[model samples]
Target: MEMNGSQRIEASREQVYAALNDVEVLRQCIPGCDSIEKTSDTEMNAKVTLRVGPVKASFTGKVTLSDLDPPNGYTISGEGSGGMAGFAKGGARVVLVPDGEATMLNYAVSAEIGGKIAQLGSRLIDGTAKKLAGDFFSKFSQIVGPQPAGDDAPAAEVAEKKGWVGRLRDSL
Candidate 1:
């Protein structure tokens, strides 16, 4: 399946980018995400529980970020196993564009599933993916608040200077 969309995030592009890379932020935003542990600068291990149609499964996965371009965006990819339920692999290209003091966040995602999950039919799988993506973005937008003029700081500064540690702190 493939899906794409854009959202107007009420935060600076830098701030949005920081949030996107923060494991804690992503853990909070992703639907049914139980945990996200950073394993490297560009990779993290994740556990998520998802329900599609009448089936529910817990998946363990590794998520990786590539093609980094600072506050602009990056490519995110991951694959997960659900044992007998199935397995899923997907990737997304995310781009962040500055819009005044806000940011325009766009994403294109491509995914595939096999085993029992694939047998559930495209309509069901597509609907579930869309719902999950929507849920993530809505939660993401809420956490990445618009910085007030007087108390604003670009998160990209932290990412560039102190790496993920500083970015994580700023994200929180």
Candidate 2:
């Protein structure tokens, strides 16, 4: 599966970029993330527990950051195993663009699942992926500060914009 999206973070681009590289922040934001320890400037070990439908599993893995461009963006890739449960491998490229005092964070990611977990079907996986991504971004936006989680009402002028449709869909 693949996901690509963007959000306006209330923090500065530099601050957001630095926070993106911080394993502690990542652990705190990632749902089910149990622990993470940095092994080097670009590598870390992590443990996470995940539940989908009626199945639950604990995963252990190593994450590596590559193609760094400091205070701007980078690519992250990792592979994890969950014993008899399954295995997952994925990669994402995250970019930070300055937006006044805030940061416009964008990302594109791809992932593959295998073993028993893959048998659950794509609809479940797709829905869960959307939820997980929404949850993560919501938490991150909250931490970065005000996210205008305000009224979704759109002006007549905005109703004609393509992005306005997305905003309406997201609000739902």
Candidate 3:
């Protein structure tokens, strides 16, 4: 399957680019992510649990970043296995453009799956992929992007309310 979309982040292109390369940022942004460890500057290993349709499984994956372009963008590719459940492989080209103080992020993604997971039908897989992508970007924006005005709650109180993501941001 293939999908593409864009988002306007309330941060500079440099901030967005740096956050995209940060392991902690990604760990927090990825839904169902158990952990992410950087093997190198351009490589990482991750464990995640996901549910598609009625199948729920844990996936271990390796991700690699290529085509370095600083604050512009890069290509990211990854593959993961879920034991008997299936395997998934995909790649995405991400681009970041400055929009005044904010950044406009664009991405084009292509993915494939095999084994029992593939049998779940394209509609199910496609929907799940879209949802996962949306979740990641939304969380990433919330973390790296600027907070809206008039929210003056203390960091401890806000973190408690926002859960792990908020706590992670506060720690950073």
Candidate 4:
């Protein structure tokens, strides 16, 4: 699956970038995330739990940031396993752009799963991923403050573009 989102943050570009890099902030921001800790400057570990259809499971994984352009952009990739349940791995490219008085936080994420999770089918996985992303940003905006311009059309477009299937399942 692929994902995209845009958030207007109250914090400055540097502050938002720093927060995005921080494991503590990310852990709190991620829906179902239990913990996140830095194992190294470029790598970190995370534990997240969620339910997809009838299956519920927890995942522990490692993530690493690559091709960083400090306070501007970078690619993050990670893989997590859930014992007999399944495994998930994905990468996301994040970019911070200045938009008038707010910083526009943009992300492009792609993810894949194997084992039981993949068997759940694409619709469930796609909706679940979309929900998770939406949950993360909704809370993130609360932390960053509100958008004064009041136009959220751009953000909605980004979210819709994430999936090829509009409703049940379209096509890629």
Q: Tens-digit lDDT track for model 3 on 57-129?
A: 9999999999989999999999999999999999999999999999999999999899898999999999999
Q: Candidate 4 lDDT, tens digit per residue, 34-122?
A: 99999998999989998999999999999999988878978999999988899999999999998776789899999989999899999
Give the Cα error of residue 34 in candidate 1, in Å. 0.8
Q: What ranges in model 1 sit over 4 Å off?
A: 147-172
Q: Which of candidates 1 and 2 is the stronger one according to TM-score?
A: 1
Q: State, as a TM-score between 0 and 1, how close model 1 is to the true structure.
A: 0.84
By TM-score, the best candidate is 3
Error of 1 at 162 (Å): 40
lDDT minimum window of 10 residues, candidate 1 = 147-156
Order of quality (lDDT)? 3, 1, 2, 4
Q: What TM-score goes with each of the models?
A: 0.84, 0.82, 0.88, 0.81
Q: lDDT of each model, Cα atoms only?
A: 0.91, 0.86, 0.93, 0.85
Cα deviation in Å at residue 117, candidate 4?
Answer: 1.1
